[model samples]
Target: MLGFIDSADSHLMSTRSCGACSLHSSHRHALEEIRKVPISKRQILCLIALAYGNFCVAACVSLQAPFFPAECDNKGVSSQVYGLIFGIYELVILTASPIFGKMFAYVSPNFFLESGLFLAGITTVLFGILDRIADSLQFTVLAFSLRIFEGAGAAAFLTSCYTIMPLEFPDHISFLFALLETFFGLGLIVGPTVGGALFEVGGYITPFAVLGTCMILGSLVSIILLPKSGGVTQSKSPSVFAFLCDIGTLLDVLTIAGCLNLIGFNAATLEHHLRQFNLSPTKIGSIFIITGSVYALTNPLWGKLGEYKFDARWMSILGTAINIVGLLFMGPADFLPIEPQLWLVIVSLIIVGIGMAAKQVSAYIACLNDTINRRGYPNETSTYALVSATNFSSCSAGAFLGPSVGGYLLGTIGYRASTQVILGFEILTLILLVLYKLCGS
Candidate 1:
């Protein structure tokens, strides 16, 4: 009787194994068929909605940077308080993404996308008119409140889009994702200039009002156009914790965090550092433009490389090396005899931007693929959501840390020394990538 039971259990286990293998094979064949076909009109519409959503959310996030600080000063808010106001948005995003990601088993991605857009749009418009509040305390409270809500909305919208893209464009995941990221970068590039101009014309309220209204309109359109998909099999789906358990996936997440940390570090400190040049605000904005433009333009190239089956780990290492060179020249390092020159700064910013695009895009693809291929997660929407949530959470954490740490280091240790700390981070990332490669091989 015991021998008969063992034989039955063995047969059951083999049957399950065969079923899993067949499912994976079917998924692979479906993807190959998708690759062979032309993109449908529905796919085009979905892409448009996703792209515009990315642009709107990014623009709204950045547009306030140009004028908000001065407004806070005028309202008697201290630099520390106002800076937290900026950092708090990312904090909220970091907190909210995982919840939405976990909800993927129950909620549709389209619902999150549309609702997030609506919520974000409304909060943005409400933020515009905070100038009417007379008391400093009241203004500050409302400012923080509005930003918190805005952050939540943006997190939802971004997480859903990341989830949706892999499902909608499985064949062109890397390239299409890169293209969407390019739009995001463009929005970042355009936001400050547009905000500055609009502020000049109509003060604090105008930029937010206009951008927010447009975003709301965009959200409404997405409701009609975005593709609809059902949730995944909850029984088979792994938790976000499960996904992160894979060492390679965890390192990829860290790589993403490190990349964004450099970006946020620059955003907080670079303008202040450029003050030494006695350049006007307009000129400073132009210098800032250099990095965004380069990053945006070069992303698709990296994405193409990803589609070509480039080894993401090696790409990350190469990109990190380039970023180190950029940072070395960015401060003209203390060891170097040369003074920091504008021309050299320009060149360094460009190099940093290119490296950033490479590192960021490759890390994203690596995380997604590693989760599916090596980690044995299903190639389904739930896995996508979990990966997207993890990546976005890392991004928010990095963004939040970057400015806070950058500002503290800039104040305490001064600019060049602060950059050395950041350089150390990149070097550490490089070392890890090389080790990951060596170990995997």
Candidate 2:
């Protein structure tokens, strides 16, 4: 499912051992790393600053849902038309990812960031204006045009952040990634909660205006705080296909990396599907926050786990298996004749949340190990963009397909049967893990 890691090369870590490898490896690694590499407090702040900026933009993405309803209603717009506009926004980005990813090697990232923000602001203001008018195909088209600009803008910003972190902070890499994800968790927690409040307090335009100002502000912050990235100045590289066709030591790195990405996305799909059960958005958000917060809290442990001899694949399988079992229990606890106890649902969510945390940490650490073993330093730029793109695309496909799949399973077979689908997928993942071991042997 993940395109960057060449699947064929992931087969080499055959003689694995030490599931009990020390858990303090990340802490130890960081301290020893300090002896070799030193940096000021200001540098660390800059990295956090980049992470903070990225999450602010991402949080605003979901804010549109709450904002759109009021804006559309004020203009006498039907919900269906607004829904269409929102759905089409994904399509625009879907088309743009490959085009941007391919040409990414040649483009100047800073220029890309500036251009994206400029278009985003212009288009977003137009969106607010469109909200004040009656429905017209003309307005619909204009709205979509703006969303495309925003997508391009957001994508560039995200990828650039990935590129920048490796350059700015090289020593404390594991902790750095963990902190990045922690901020991502915070954004998920804060976005809807804050967005919901913004919509309630000030009309629809208030949130958009707020988001526009933040995006502009983030751009300014990025310009001042992030030094020019320390990676290759620019690659006059050949097209992406040629790069893909040529491979050497990096192949194994790519292989495990792809596996890591595939599992991550598949897990995200499960999360989205779990929330689709007629739950209130607040409840859904609550569940995510619980999962995200706890996951962020305990997840740094895997940095130590990654340094061990055990292949990260098994950790993924184990975590996925736990996740599936939790879903199995959670689904039936919701729909089966057994009296619905809220505790069961809560417990189930906690279980799945921990499972997701382990899965993400293991997969990424394995990818990091591979990256470090090869590059002498992590290729944070390439790894971040490739993994994010791969995992997100996979999860997007699954999430888009999940409703219909689950609906059919739930509607025709029943809720119990629908939940069993996760059961089957988890089993498949385990089998794949075994297959990976055998192939490596």
TM-score of each: 0.77, 0.64
lDDT of 2 by residue, 178-231 (tens): 456555556656655565566566755666677667667766776676555422
Error of 1 at 47 (Å): 4.4
Deviating ranges (above 4 Å) for candidate 1: 1-47, 70-80, 102-111, 130-139, 162-179, 223-235, 276-283, 303-311, 331-340, 365-387, 435-441
Residue 364 of model 1, lDDT score: 72
Candidate 1 lowest-lDDT run of ten: 1-10
Model 2 scores worst on lDDT over the 10 consecutive residues at: 6-15
User: CA lDDT of each candidate?
Assistant: 0.73, 0.50
Candidate 2 has a TM-score of 0.64
Instruction: Show where candidate 2 strays beyond 4 Å.
Output: 1-27, 31-49, 64-107, 117-147, 170-175, 203-205, 228-284, 302-311, 333-335, 338-345, 365-424, 435-441
lDDT of 1: 0.73
Instruction: Please name the candidate that would achieve the greatest TM-score relative to the true structure.
Output: 1
